[model samples]
Target: MDQAIQGKIEEALKGLFTAVSMLQDAYPGKPFTPDGRLVGDIGEVVASLAYELTLNEGLTKHHDAVTDDGRNVQIKTTFGTSLTFPVHHVPDYYLGIRMNRDGSFEEIYNGPGHLIQAQLSGRKATKTGLHGGLMAMLKRINQQVPDSERIPKR
Candidate 1:
């Protein structure tokens, strides 16, 4: 089920990336790249029976999509099932896409901030230490750049 959900999320992100890429291509030097960074969920659930059952449960996933050009996207997914009782609920899948300088790609689910940062930095996170390194890099970037400049100043 996880694999299937991952596939669906990936597909959705690809479509979004393509549209964004087109806009970037149409306007060169406008600071556009498929490798751009984004955070947060594209969608959120206002009300859910699952929350009622799980005692106000909430979830968010970042980096749900990436373009072939190295753009990164965050996605939030919600699962809805036609059945109730016995607690049968579909899982909401979040995807984070990272493109390597070597042209490789990695998609992560339910990742931490450091892990996502590593991906954005063209590093593959295979160990806990690597995650720490990624976090450090992210901290540095955050400190160096103002919030307004972080995302195209718009």
Candidate 2:
């Protein structure tokens, strides 16, 4: 990356981290979990910007965003190994994103909801049970799509 571009990326990341920290302090008792929903929100923002999708705000029944081609996408984020999907309400597509500790994406997986559900049908719904098989499924799905449709590790 160009030095100037790298500098700008660092500045933006610093701002994001500062804002998350402030929110954590302001809402200390809120149930935002380990990082106060910072990681998940950042992952959504990254996916929205990268994939050029409109993010759905407020309460939604299933999906997080709609693609330019009108596909309903459910976005899920994890630090390294875990991914959670709603068993009953599946979207048209599921976007599994893994983020680094610094909030940058480590990998991205886009696949149909049915395929993912099939893979997890008789398995435990935990990180240890789901990580390997889900990752393999993502890899196969990624291979079937164009480069623009997938985000590989950096």
The best candidate by lDDT is 2
Tell me how candidate 1 scores on lDDT.
0.32
Q: Write the per-residue lDDT of candidate 1 for residues 1-154, one digit (tens) a residue.
A: 1345446655766776677668889987674433312322322111111111111224423333332324343332222111111112122222322332222233223322333343355434343322222323433344544332222200
Q: What are the per-residue Cα lDDT tens digits for candidate 2 across 57-108?
A: 8647678888876778887887656666665555687788876545456455
The C-alpha TM-scores of every prediction are 0.29, 0.62
| Residue 153 in candidate 1, Cα distance off native in Å | 35
Give me the overall lDDT of model 2: 0.64
Cα lDDT computed for each candidate against the true fold: 0.32, 0.64
Candidate 1: Cα lDDT at 151: 21
TM-score of 1: 0.29
lDDT of 2 at 46: 71
Q: After superposition, how far is residue 130 of candidate 1 from its true place, in Å?
A: 23
RMSD of each: 17.9, 6.6
Per-prediction backbone clash count: 8, 0
